[model samples]
Target: MLKNRFNIAASLLAIILSVGFIGAPIGPNNGDPTGGRPTNGRPTDDGPNPKQTIALGDRREIFADRFLIREMKGARLVMHPPRDEGPVMHFDQPWESNAPAYITILKDGDTYRAYYRGGHQRANGKKEDNTCYAESRDGIHWEKPNLGLIEANGSKNNNIILEESPLTHNFTPFLDNNPSAPQNQRFKAIGGTNKTGLLPFASANGKDWKKMQEKAVINEGLLDSQNVAFWSESEQMYVCYFRTWTGGNDRGYRSVSRATSPDFLHWSKPVEMTFGDRPYEHIYTQQTSPYFRAPHIYVAIGSRFVPHRQIATLDQLNELKVDPGQHKGLSEPFLMTSRGGNVYDRTFMEAFIRPAMGLNHWSARTNYPSLNIVPVGDGEMSLYVNQDYAQPTGHLRRYSMRLDGFSSINAPYEGGAVKTKTLTFTGKALEINYSTSAIGEVRIALQDENGKDLPGFSLLDSEQLVGNEVARTVTWNGKTDLSAWAGKPVQLHIYLKDADLYSIRFK
Candidate 1:
């Protein structure tokens, strides 16, 4: 009887070992019972468990991407369109009657400067294009100053800045913000064709420009569009985003390429930007620049061109006086973002600046945005666009939005919650740019690294935040200061009810 009992026990032990039940149980954290390793087999050194905590030190984070969001219950990220401000200036001059394209506007100190190409064929039968200039005290009211630099229409009384043939076809300029940049090169520009490569020009006062080099500085990629270059404060270098053909040999869809330079003259090898897993589309003009408020994040309001996608009828085209062969393709603006890298995060793949309520807006090349978004008023920023292209009514229009209002974390009346990834910040209080209805409210809770609500900072203790404001300080139980939790790794549990949270910063 004893021998039989021993045999049974031995048989049971053998079965248990065969089923692999001797170790810890499988879990969501890559089967690691301690939750030390992520599913990607990477080991994290911060926080309590599966993921790493981010060190976001007092930088304003916009809801344009999912870089800081960890989880959400019923809230969603939504994109907001700008309000149309109507046409500010028309291409009505004799030299600008044909088409005025590739517009660029920048805020230089107290003054606003604008640059664009004026395309027209002279009476001598010479097809020449000139770079024109305009100025504005405020961004809304513009004046075409008589530059008197280049002669057009048998006189030098127009706002013609430069008449260099191929260069003026698409001359784009930017105000340099590099602290080390010489005063003589305060304003820099890049303009040329694919055949001539890209030529570099510099100016001290932005009205007079001269070539920095006799030869083209950048020779790689197709330099046919409004190639933009600027001093990147975050990257501490000069970066340029230009046009390129994806599949090479000028075959595939239109794309963008980037290159860096320690100085403006010597550039590194160009790297084509990648949009991960998104469907291929022609990106005609990539007006990419760093957001003025958040210099670390780059915003691109690019023109998405769809070839042969005609939307206007023949009657509508004839009524609008659109030029022949330019009505076959349609283009609209789309928004993209990046964090100083070659990968663009196209969160919203839809049209950002849609066509207006007229058939003329549905024509080809009608809504290309300018290169930069500049602050115009308190808590307000504006962007410019070229409208009614290839028509006699070609003009520039302004669009306005609240600062850092590109995208938002929105919730309906029923309410929802968004929990941020673990992070450490440096400021004593939290500020949010948000809007809400009459009955809507927002509440915030502070959670520890382990996801437990900290005492005195739970949702029950948070005061209800109501009304619409661009920068409102968040408080808990009438306490506004958060200096105690400044350097600690914590998570934000944002509860919203019929509200839109545009951006947040620790200040």
Candidate 2:
């Protein structure tokens, strides 16, 4: 049987070669430009079935308009703030006091760990930076435990995890999620100057670091910012996003570049990320990390800097006692989401978390978020930011958002509707993460792949849902059963009024 199959395959290949049918697309989106197509790729009237079978997984689908969406009402991005007006961790230590910045936090088991750059100190006679450490229990309160790992300022009683090298400058480490990664290389990091190139570092416990190799893993343009590299579960490869230049009418812009590596050692040529129709600006520290719950959507709370956008007066600046450079340039954390492919959706060209009302927070480079966002409380995740940069009051502050709450398909008291493209799912019931006003309500309707209303799951049958919940199941006229519809192609028509739908997934 195997021999006969091989013989048939070989005969077909020979026939195709003889007819010169190489590189021909055999199916939809198979590089077949000649296929009957539409802008939205909806099946033409009297054409093929308009259904798309989704893979078997409860993927957190956001309201990014990645697929076909229609009649979405007054939906927009919402900003989140810290629980209180305070910094989670302060730069009070002698070694970290000079200019503590480039913060990265990760949750390991029970304890949450943090790392930041310790700038040069005149009294300590240190000229370069050091990687300092901090830990937290609730992410709201942070402490720099004296690990005694690296000696600094004439003593080892410090939170310095990495020091005495250039790796300390912007050293960012990520928990290597690669199943095949070595036990000794559980945590991997990349940090170096553009001139010297990016060097790879690995650690067994994130405390003890070792160089991956003598050579640099990635060498590219203008990597002075906090360059981030991580293992993508969605893409199943190591992706590195760093700073570079985009030479166009948009010259001298502090842009972001992306590259992928299979082994985290060798990397492809980096390409600059494009924000469709968005104006050019200085995107400093593109803290691009995978959304823990929704790894497919790479969320970036980047520090968008304005080179000369001064918001501080001389007396305000003098009160903060910050460096002169703090008088110029301003920065705030902005929300950017990307579904891989080197494309970012800047749907909300606004600050996700703005600087607070203070003289210290109004300085240049302030409000820069940490390298990672970690899930903290139930249905809440935290994003830490470096505030009052170059000032004596410099500190790492925390901001929290509801899970999958970055953006939403919101509607006013006057109702609006959103219809999804055809998709096949393999789950019994659908659940949503949403919030609504006391009077607001949301209703969901199920339709066939061709937009025909399902018999018992149509709009008239959907029960009016109201309330705020991280997970709420959709019911239709007291009917919660959807087992029969599992593994079938369908569409979701959601009518939202005075509510925001963050995400939806079949369970």
Candidate 3:
């Protein structure tokens, strides 16, 4: 079986909007209270849910659309903090700050355990690196564990638990990954190193890690050194994901790579992974990192910054825009595939929706979207888009829908939106007709109560439609008897990119 991988490309943006709901109720309908509609005092609950508003608090924030590419012809470059809102933490120190490539969530009884790699960086001109630790009760706010574990260049007082040993700089950590496999009490971690050979350290408790006495877990002898690992049940084997570079570009060296591992021990050689223009076209990028299986799927997050954003305004002033051209990517999320060999290749690529409104750019004020997939129903899931669009202060805006209904990730239509209407009935086929200027595109998928996309039911079919007079007409010719879609509470995902619907008839 092929390895299933999900990558969220870096290019986080913050979006901000200044709007308030006078009378909005914050209650849990299903997933997040933020996924509800607002009450506009019309004797009906047909308004934006006030509870869904995300507050930017004291950081530089923006709307989620900044990096999400919600609009096709929108802005391409979105900064982390919209403006110098004073001390915005877009890119922090200790190199580990940006080293959030992979993360794992462990269920230690009633407590949810999280282990992540703090990337490498020089502190105030120091050569050492460090990894931090934090635990969460509700998986939201985290508290530091007062353990004596510490990594290299880290303070015993700070959240540092394990310092980089002689093996290499301490990296990401993973615990008892294979649940279906034996109940082995195994733990592992991988990262970069300055030593000649043997890197990566494994331990029983995160504190006392032992160096891999065997081959190097991951050592391509290149820069941007980062490695992530996890266990897979489908294949019944352990797997690792990592990145590395090859040569240099106009600005500097250019590297795009990925790799997989069977056991946390011996690692396969690195394989190159590239997207977009010439390798050197984009600058300052990190390999894709892996995340744990919460809702049940191998998730990875990778980041890269377009040098154009970092350039002095007077230099590349013509490249800036309010609506970014996100599709032409230098930075975006993608799906990775693990074939037989050591390298895990990229299957499909798409822009990850930022939890906030805008892109994480340097010039203008911006915010990067925080993203995570949530389970909606048996075969449905919802995308919780927490944005600060409505209020410059920041507010949560939600768009819920099924995961499999749309043909492609870039389907112009979203699952749950103001214009989205839910239709229920019992029949062999489902058809829809609308009245609008043009029906931009059609996305037919199922979703959950929270409007997240489900995994199993992702049967997608898309087509570019032509406009018919003032109203446009589109239909879903069920390839399979969709009678199953009826009576069982299924969602119909219809996107109105360029058209509106006056009436929707199902037959």
Model 2: CA > 4 A from native: 1-56, 64-68, 73-85, 122-126, 248-250
Scanning candidate 1 in windows of ten residues, the lowest lDDT window is 39-48
Q: TM-score per candidate, in order?
A: 0.88, 0.86, 0.45
Ranking by lDDT: 1, 2, 3
**lDDT tens readout by residue for model 2, 281-375:** 88888899988887877888899988877877888787778887558888888877777867776656667776778767777888888887788
Clash pairs detected, candidate 1 = none
RMSD of each: 11.2, 12.7, 18.4
Count of clashes in candidate 3: 99
Clashes of each: 0, 0, 99
TM-score for candidate 2: 0.86
For candidate 1, what's the RMSD? Answer: 11.2
Per-residue error for 186 in candidate 1, Å, reads 1.4
Kindly give the stretch of ten consecutive residues in candidate 3 with the minimal lDDT sum: 8-17
lDDT of 2 at 66: 38
